[model samples]
Target: MALIRSILFNLLFFPGTAIHCFGVLAVSPMGSGPVQAIVHSWSRMHYWLLRHVMGISFEWEGKLPAGPYLIAVKHESMVEAIDTLRFADTPVVVLKRELADIPVFGRVTRRYGVIPVDRDAGATALRQMMSLAKQAVVDRRPVIIFPEGTRVPRGARPQLRPGFAGLYRMLGLPVVPIAVDSGRVWPRGFVKRSGTIHFRVGEIIPPGLKREEVEARVHAAINALNLPTT
Candidate 1:
C-alpha cells in the first residue's frame, strides 16, 4: 500500500502543481474576488487529489469559528496547511517569506492572498503581518497562522513562536486553536503514507486576554487533542 501510494503521489504531485500554476497565470492581474475563486477551486481540487492519490482521510472534530477570527494551528506537516484550504472558506495564510521565492508555487500562493513574512526581519515582519491581517479581517476573510512557526515530527512538541501574541493583541480578534495528527500520516519529507489524519478544533479564545494567557490556552488545546485520551 505504501509503495502504491508513493507511486501515485509521484505521478500526480507535479501535474497538480502544474495545473495550479496555470490557473495562477490565467488569474493574474485579475481582481481579488476572481483570483480567490480560482485559488479556492485549485485548493479544493488539490486536497481531493491528495486524498485520492495518497489514500489519506481527514477527521475534523469540533467546529470552525465564523468570520474575523484568528486561527492559530499547530504545524506538524505541510499537509495541514494544504488541508486547511479545504475547510476555510477563503483564508489568508501567514506563511514564511521563503515560500514566495518558489517558482510556480510562489506565484500561486501570492495570487491567493497568502501573506509572506520575512523570518529574518523581526519587528518588520510583525508589523507587516499585523497590517495584512487587519486588512484581511476587514475584508471578511479569516486569518490562519501556525503558532509553532515550523513543522515538527509526529508526536514531537515544538515551542510556539512569540509573534502570535503580538498579532493576537494587535488584531484583538478571537483566536481559534486547531490541532492535528497530519504528521503521523504525512510525516514530513516522506513520499507517501496511507492513513487517516485527525484534526481537533478547540474552543475560541476571546480577545483582550493577556499574551501568555492566550498562548497557554492554545497550547493546552493542542496538548489535549494530542493526548491519548482523544
Candidate 2:
C-alpha cells in the first residue's frame, strides 16, 4: 500500500512541479515575488497531496519568526525544506552549491536568491555565502539554513557545521531555531509513510554570543525535537 501511494505521489508531483517551474520561468523577470509565489504554490500543493493522498499531515507548534531573521532548522527530510517557503514570504535558503546548477531547475534557485555553499572551498565559500545572505537580510527576507549541513535520520544528533555560527555573527541577526520530526514519516528519497510531522519552533537566540555559546544553544534547541517522549 505504501509503495503504491508513493508511486502515485510521484506521478502527481512532477507534472505539477513542471507547470509551476514553467510559470516561474515565464515571470521571473518581473521579480522575486512572482517567482516566490510559484514556489509557495508548489509547496502547498505538495503538502496537500501528502495529506489527502498519502494520509500524511503536519502538526506545527509555535509561530514563524518575523522576516530578516535567520531560521535555523533541523534538517531531517525534504519536507522541512519545502515547508520553509510556507513560513516566510520569500525565504533565502542555504543549499549546497550543486543544487543551483541542475539544468532547468537551477534557474529557480538562482532567481529565488538561494545561498549556495561550496563546502570544499572552506572559508572562501563562507565569505561568498555571507555576502549573498547579507543581501537577503537587507531585503527583509527570512534566511533558512540547516545547521547540520545535511539531513540526518530521526534521533541522530550532530553538531552544527561551522558556517552556521559564521552567518549568525556576520549577519548580526537574531536566529530562530526550528526543530522538525519530518524524517520519521518522510525519510529521504521516494518513500513517505503516513504520519504526522511536527515542527517545534524554539525561542529566538539573539546575536553577539560567542561561537561556542551560539552553537550549543542552536544544537540543543534543535535536538530537543528528537528526544523520546512518553
Candidate 3:
C-alpha cells in the first residue's frame, strides 16, 4: 500500500512540478515573487499529495524570525527545503552549485536568486557563496542555509560543515537555527512514510562571536532538536 502511494505521488509530482516551473517562467519574468509562487504552489501540492496519497502531515513549533535574519536549518529531507517558502517570503536558499545544471529547474532557481555553494572548490566556492549571500542580505532578503551541507538521516549526528561558520561570521547577521524531523517521514531516497514532520525554530544566536563559540552554540541548538524527548 505504501509503495502504491509513493508511486502515485511521484507520478503526480514530477509533471506537476515541471508545469508550475514553466508557468512561472512564462508569466513572471525575472521576479522572485512569481518564482516563490511556484515554490508555494508546489509546497501546497506536495503536502496535499502527502496527506491524501501517503497519509502524512506536518506541523511547526516556534515562530520563524520576522525580519532579515540568517537561518541555518536542519537538513533531513527535501520536504523542509521546499517548505522553506512557507516559512519566509522568498528567502535566498544556499544550495549546492551542481543544482544549477538541472535544466529547467536550474533556470527557475536562478530566477529565485538562490545562492549556490560549490563544495569541491574549497575557498573559491565559499567566497562565491558568501558574496552572493551578502548581496541577498543587502537586498533585505532572509538567507537560509543547511549547516550540515547535505541531508543526514534521522539519528545521524554529523558536525556542522565549515561553510556555515564562515557565513555566520562574514554575513554579520543574527542566526536562527531551525530543526525539523521531516526525514522520519520523507526519507532522502523517496519512499514516503506516514507521520507528522515537525519543524522547531531555535533561539537567535547573536552575531560577532568567535568561530568556535558560534559553531558550538549553533551546533548544540540544531542537534538538540533531533534528540528524543526525555
lDDT of 1 at 29: 76
| Per-residue accuracy of model 2 over 126-209 as CA lDDT, tens digit each | 778889998998899989999999989888898899889889989999999999888788876777789888888898999999
lDDT of 2: 0.87
- In order, candidate lDDTs are 0.79, 0.87, 0.82
Give, for candidate 2, the lowest lDDT window spanning 10 residues.
221-230
Candidate 1 per-residue lDDT over residues 1-230, each given as its tens digit: 78777777767766876886787778687767777776777677768767888888888899897787889888877787876786886899988889976987888788787778787787777678788888988888888998878787666666678877877888888988998877667765557678888888898899999778898998878755563312
Put down candidate 3 lDDT per residue, 19-125, tens digits, no spaces: 98897788665566667777778778876887888888777778876777889888888887887876686689989888866888887787878998887787777
Candidate 2: count of backbone clashes, pairs at least 3 residues apart or interchain: 0
Error of 1 at 150 (Å): 0.5
* TM-score of candidate 1 to 2 decimals: 0.92
Q: For each candidate, what TM-score against the reference?
A: 0.92, 0.95, 0.92
Q: Model 3, residue 146: displacement in angstroms?
A: 0.6
lDDT of 1: 0.79
- Best candidate (score: lDDT): 2
